[model samples]
Target: MNRSADIMILDLSESSAYKTNLKHIDFCGSPVINKDHWLYWGSRVLSTSEASTSNVLMRVAEQTEFLDDETFETIAGCSKSENYSQRCSRTSLQSRDKLMYIQKEQLGLESEFPQHLLPDGKFNVDGFILACDVSKETVLHSNHVINIAKSIAKTKKPIVIAFTKCDEMSEECKRHYMTLFLATKELKHVLCNLPPVETSAVKNVNVEYLFGSLAMLCLRSQKLVKKPPLAYHEASLFVEQRNLHVKCCFSTLLSQAVPLCVYPKKFLSWKQVLADIDRHPDLMNFVEVFGSRVAFEMYERYVSEAKELWAMNRLRSHVPRLFEVFQVFLGVVDLADMEWNMARDYMRCHPLFSVLFENNDYDLGMWSPSTFNVDEKSRLPAEILLLPEAGNVFEQFRVGRSDGVVAIVNGK
Candidate 1:
């Protein structure tokens, strides 16, 4: 019984069709390569000598389960016809098996499995790579690839993303490939940052890296020695980093929370606020800020305000949180005053004011020279009024003014 023969490689490349056929020649009792371009097998060693045509060695000892010959024949025929130039020669067996064996062994799957199944009769292979043809663009095909990859990854194995047609992809196709590559990298990062084993894939980019990682994981699982838990400090560090990431996301949302001024009186209703926030390009960021119950409460309150309440509420909510975290304005007495002034300034400069006050009876003549010029002494009023030291001067001015005023006493 050869435990090392547990792993196998299923190559779906045009070059591997003949070699894949040689699985029928002997009872290797290991895994067999399948038409799906997946290596449905397990391995025992972290690394094995490269398989060779002259020295064909069995890597695993378990009986391989394969579909019937008819299926195999159909697949083989398709490979030959579809990929004529790269088709594997069907002439020889010894050579073919050796090639197949070598190709399968190269993936390195020793780290995936435990010494054996976990008392439960489950089949585990250190991880398997489910390679697929990039030429196929159908949603069904991609789904099939994903399903197969998922099934293999579920066996506590890391999957290697592999693809064909690397040499034939167009520039645009290559760009798409790079996009997928970055997406895959992001997926891996997300998985690693998470509790582990949350995501896996079998695609073209990083396939080899995935294979090597899977091998290491399988080997670790086999050792059955529980790794020591992280120290408190280390755990704390991880938590801090995670928090930093969340804060960064919130900052992004805050940056994008500029006033849209679409509603009348610049007053965005709660529904409008929700709709606008929901349209944010980075929805995750919005969710981080406005997704919580507290944030939603603030959002509702701000939306009900008369003018651009959403922006005002967002600023207010964020300012407190920011101060709490960074302690920026702890001793600052006029923080709220400064914040309200800033909001007022922003509203005053906003272009929406032209539209918001278009229907109102109150005139903005004070701000315009055409209506009331500063150089005209006739417009000046007597008893120069001062706002009694407490309330806002602007509010008093708005309330106290009539159409025009005249000087009271004789002046020099």
Candidate 2:
């Protein structure tokens, strides 16, 4: 919403959602390339007659569209063919535009804009200003904008909804806005419980605040980028300042310091790691050789024997067995694309670790030379370790790390 913002308005001429916004809504005259669907849209600014309000232009596209007779016949022939998929593929290869239209129904075309046109690292917009007219005609379109905004940014950009033509809204229209905001509160990019700024250039009401919010958002985003990372003590102090329980934050930090046993460099596989641990009943060597490599990597940095033993003990207590540690490491590698600070916290608080530690009646205590238990040794292999179940449980853990970080920071 900045005064100097470089805005790009796309004229989605073929879109059903945008059809009403056009001066002359004529879809029946346009030719259809395919029976599946046909939408002819281009990038253009809204005409003065089309734009009823001064708010910035935004668009929401729908997959559904109409097709002409010849195109419909071609598609129908392709469908009826014995090699339907093959024919479809050939058609796509022949005409890229046709393929694009066909793919729109199954996979959203907007996804291509983010993935291809705006590849990661190339473009970084400060924020997105979603301008919508608050009326029955745009009710569904507004929701679509919210959804598409989230899809485009994916938590990268802060979204500020500017409800245009607010001065023209009725009491019923006002109620609708409230209902819509409440319904979309769970969406990621949209600020939770925060109502859209009721704006009107015609009335000159809340227009300044709408733009000011954009500037403030840009400043906040910049501050986050320039801010230095907090040290351990500083982070603890930060948690305390936020009214989080100091003791819990300290405990969580301490959990990270507690050294786990060092794991081997090259793993033979999960089966091999388990088999080796079974063959060599020595807990110290078992842990030192087959524990978490991530833990082992941390262990190498610590000079004190007490800290090392504490770490080793923690590894034994929380992630004792070879297979469990292996699985945890797999989860670690799987989410390597995530930020380190976020990923580590997830590794600490994720419930999968709790299940790994708490489920089995076995607790491999601190490593010692003279300890040998035949009964526990016999029971180890027979005790079922559901690897697939653990994977399924933590499947969402990486994606939900933001929530996990909030919980940890709040001492929850």
Candidate 3:
């Protein structure tokens, strides 16, 4: 463990599993809001706190105080979307002594590159964010993802791989991943051009240096900015990397991108986007994958619509209200605001998120027993793995030019 700046940093970056320096007595913690659930925490930090050099998880300054509410996360005069308070978590608690830390639940948020990269509003590269829970015993990825990757590979298109969840990763794995990334001809150039630094995701800073080769690969990857389409210059790539907390690091890598056309434009809101997505068939495959956009819309709609969920005589919007009812039920406040809020909902945010979107893989109900299959790894789908000769020079000649650059990353 070392100190970077004024904060004492704990290095949990060892490749080996947790070998205890020592263990302390377990304790229970309560909230200031007079909440139901109590934090049963086991002291993990002994000599020094287990922190990474780039760790944003624990802030010694912030930990000095006890905040029970998002009350401190307020803004003077800004919309919920623009508020820095969104950066502060509500359910999480930070101890003044900094011995225990509350594991964060998902906020139903996603960060994706824009769908229209260039000013022409045409998209070329395919983007995907595959997620795995490191807290789980095994990391699970879908067979469908492998199938899509294989198909993309068969066409001889450009493909990039970035592994996230760096904070949870061991130092050895970080080095290995960095080495692999740098070994790639394109990614090597990207790292060299940009300084290696880390910061909070909400800062929303931008530096234009993907594999700038993304432009050489696609005539469109030319001069670009991370701002929205309106900030786009004529014939330049314009993609607004919107609201994703961790996207500050990952989004810049995709050079050939398509802007969402929904964000950063005052005229278009999430409600309008959601309405358009539902109403028009032509915009169905508007982009290859709409997970991030759909996620953003879902979160916005969920929070905003829940305000009106209790209409006098109407069926409630299941997905959004269910999220609210499942969560706010235990609390005294938000009762008059909620539509018949009376559930014993002390469940974790993840499980509740699963049921709220039943079609998704996570099903705590036991009805959809198989959200992920471990056997999917045996089916290697990349064509190069199957068809490439040991050392055939002619094979290079046979390969087609890269038509697109596709990235598939684990969203852990």
The candidate that wins on TM-score is 2
Query: Which is better, 1 or 2, measured by TM-score?
Result: 2
Error at 294, model 3, angstroms: 3.9
Q: Could you list the CA RMSD of all candidates, in the order they appear?
A: 22.5, 27.1, 32.6
Candidate 1 residue lDDT tens string, 268-380 = 44465557677554555445433566455645443334233333322232221221211222222223334334534443465543432232332223323233223322222
Where does candidate 3 stray beyond 4 Å? 1-168, 177-213, 216-241, 244-412
- Lowest summed-lDDT stretch of 10 residues in model 3? 106-115
TM-score of each: 0.24, 0.26, 0.19
Model 2, residue pairs in steric clash: 258-311, 259-311
lDDT of 2 by residue, 1-412 (tens): 3122222111111123322211111222112222223232221222222132233322211222233333432222223342221221111111123322223222333334322211111112344555556543333545344445444345354556666665565556556655665566444335441346666655445654555445445444323222222322343354345323433343233233332333221213334433444434332332432344532432334324434454344333322243334345443455636544444455446655454434354333422212322233222221223333334334444445434421111122
Instruction: Predict model 1's lDDT versus the native.
Output: 0.33
In candidate 2, how many Å is residue 32 off?
Answer: 28
Q: Each model's number of backbone clashes?
A: 16, 2, 8
Worst 10 residues of 1 by lDDT: 381-390
TM-score of 1: 0.24
Which candidate's lDDT is highest? 2
